[model samples]
Structure formats: structure tokens, C-alpha cells
Target: MTERMSAEEFRAIRHEPKPSKYRNRKTVVDGIKFDSKREAQFYASLKQLERAGQVYEVELQKPYALTVNGQLVCTYRCDFAFYDAIQKRNRVVDIKGVATKDFNIKRKLMLAVYGIDVEVIR
Candidate 1:
């Protein structure tokens, strides 16, 4: 025979604070935790593009290191990346809720270091 747990015990075992509705709501889709619903929507669109053969591959949360003189300075994580066969190039995408000074710096560094332009989506 198995011991039954009480409701208070269950609640205590699974307690987690609810996220504030006023802030950007994080969503989990296909077992991936997106920063916001908008981002998840964009990811879904990417999936469609992949299915349609518009993009060769879709990468989520791609990380790039910004190096100066072969030393790591900072790291930039883009929201999405895809290879466009027609364009014959890789495109990096960033879904930004708010563009901060730090982000701008990293964007510029990415361009200087990697020579890849990030497409910002507001």
C-alpha cells in the first residue's frame, strides 16, 4: 500500500510564485521557453519558413563571442538565426522589447567582430 499525501503537503511541494501579468509574459512552446509570446510567434513563423524551404535551418538563442585582439570581451546572444540559401548568407535576428545601451554596444561589436548584421525586430 502507498501512503497518500495531503493537499497542504502537495501545495508545499509544488509551490512557485506566479509571474506578474504587468510584465512581459514568458511562454513555453514545444518545450522551449520563449522570453515573450511575440518571440514565440516569431519562432513559429520561422518554423513555417523552414517547412516551406525558405530557410535552410533555424537556430534559437545563438551565442557569439566578441573578441578584441583574440581576447574575449563580451558575448552576444541573438534570439534567432537562419541560413537563407537564396541569399547565400546567414541572418541573425533579435527580438527586442527595449533596446538598451548595452545591447547597442554588443550589436556594434558583433558587426565589427563577426561581420554579421543583426536584424532587429521590435
Candidate 2:
């Protein structure tokens, strides 16, 4: 087996590749991840919805911002958004273990501006 490299050698390795990759990738302004269990649940639910043909499209962890009067006014990341074929609108679905004051405020604002319904699933 090859001997382990010294800490100094590891530190000296080039890191320029990472920055280039980061720049090319899409950046999210705001977003949150579900704690493991919730994440699994959400993934399963999405699959079910797709099979049922209830969701036309699904946008996962999308970060969006709107500029108002030349200033960036509203910005918030949605957990999961599903498009309804019948309604022809986007709906935001968030999986939360518990509710908070901040969540309420942001949810309301996002719904109004984006014209989407926000649903919290526990």
C-alpha cells in the first residue's frame, strides 16, 4: 500500500479547479433541505404525484428573486414547487417538522408575489 501523504503535501494540492466549477454552476439565492427522514418522504411523494399525473412539472429547491423598481425587493427559496395541469399554476410545498414565525411571514409574501399556493406538510 502507498504511504499516506503529509499534511503539508495535501495542503499544497491545487484548488483552482473548484472555483471554475462553482462559477459555471447555477447559484441559488435561498433554499433549505429537509432533515433526512423528511427528504426521503418528499422524494417518495414526488414519485407518487408523477405517477398519478397530478403534477406536470416539479421544481426542486428553486431560489428566485424579483426586482421591484430597480431594487431587489423579494427573494426566497422554495422547497418544492409542482405545476398543476388543471390549475395551470405553480404551487409551493414545504416539508417542515415544526412551524415558526419567520416561515409564516415568508410563505405569505411568496404566495402573493409569485401567485402560487404554499402548503406545509408535516
Candidate 3:
């Protein structure tokens, strides 16, 4: 059986006080902005990358520590992160089949922090 945190325990997490590296990663693919099949393409690419050993899956909502001025200042829980062991670097990823306008702004901000790039999955 999978053990999970209770709602009360999970509620204690102070997410709002800090910022996440992957705040909003989804946008609508139904409209002209994105083709309906684009989502399929994105997932395909992600799978291909995984099979090629270029990237490995990362669990969602897992916290990563970021240090500033020799002090651990903040934490970010990304939707997903791919680890390139060879390069010793990681790529943060967020997947959204559809998203709202507010999500767009948050996503852009997340991209700016830590020089991380953003990928809109569909």
C-alpha cells in the first residue's frame, strides 16, 4: 500500500511563502495557438529523450534545495525534472494539457529564476 500524507499534514506545507520553479506549465492546445496533436508530439519527444538516456524521469512535487550566499534559502518543488548525470545538470519540466491566463505569467516568472528554461507541454 502507498502511504501518503493526510490532508491536514500536507496543509502545513508553506508553499505560498516561497516560489516554485515550475509554477504553471500548461496551456490550451485546442485553439489555433497550438495544434491538437501537439500534445502527442511533446510526449513523444519526452519519451524519446528518456529512451535515448538523455533524460530521466523526476517525481512531481519533490523538493529541491537552492542555496544562496552559502545558506540554504529556499526550496522549489518542480512538476518534473530530468537529470543528465553525464552533464551534472537538470532540466525542470512542467506538463499542462490546458492552462489559464494566470498560469502564463507564473510560468514565465519561474523560467527566469535559476536560468531554467520552460517547456509548455501542449
In model 2, where is the ten-residue run with the lowest total lDDT?
21-30
Predicted structure with the largest lDDT when compared to the true one: 1
Q: Each model's number of backbone clashes?
A: 0, 0, 0
**Candidate 1: tens digits of C-alpha lDDT, residues 1-122:** 99999999999878877775546788998899998988999998888888888897788998898999989999999999999877888999999888889999999998999898899998
Query: Ten consecutive residues with minimal summed lDDT in candidate 3?
Result: 27-36
Question: TM-scores across all candidates?
Answer: 0.80, 0.58, 0.39
Assess the local accuracy of residue 55 in candidate 3 as a C-alpha lDDT between 0 and 100: 72
* lDDT agreement of model 1 with the native: 0.89
Report clash pairs, candidate 2.
none
TM-score of 3: 0.39
**Predicted candidate 2 versus true structure: per-residue lDDT over 17-61, tens digit per residue:** 464321233232325344445655676777687788978678877
Model 1 clashing-pair count: 0
Per-residue lDDT of 31 in model 1: 94
Report the Cα lDDT for residue 109, model 1.
95
lDDT (0-100) at residue 66 of candidate 3?
53
Q: Pairing residues by index, what is the TM-score of model 1?
A: 0.80
Best by TM-score: 1
The C-alpha local distance difference test score for the whole of candidate 2 amounts to 0.68
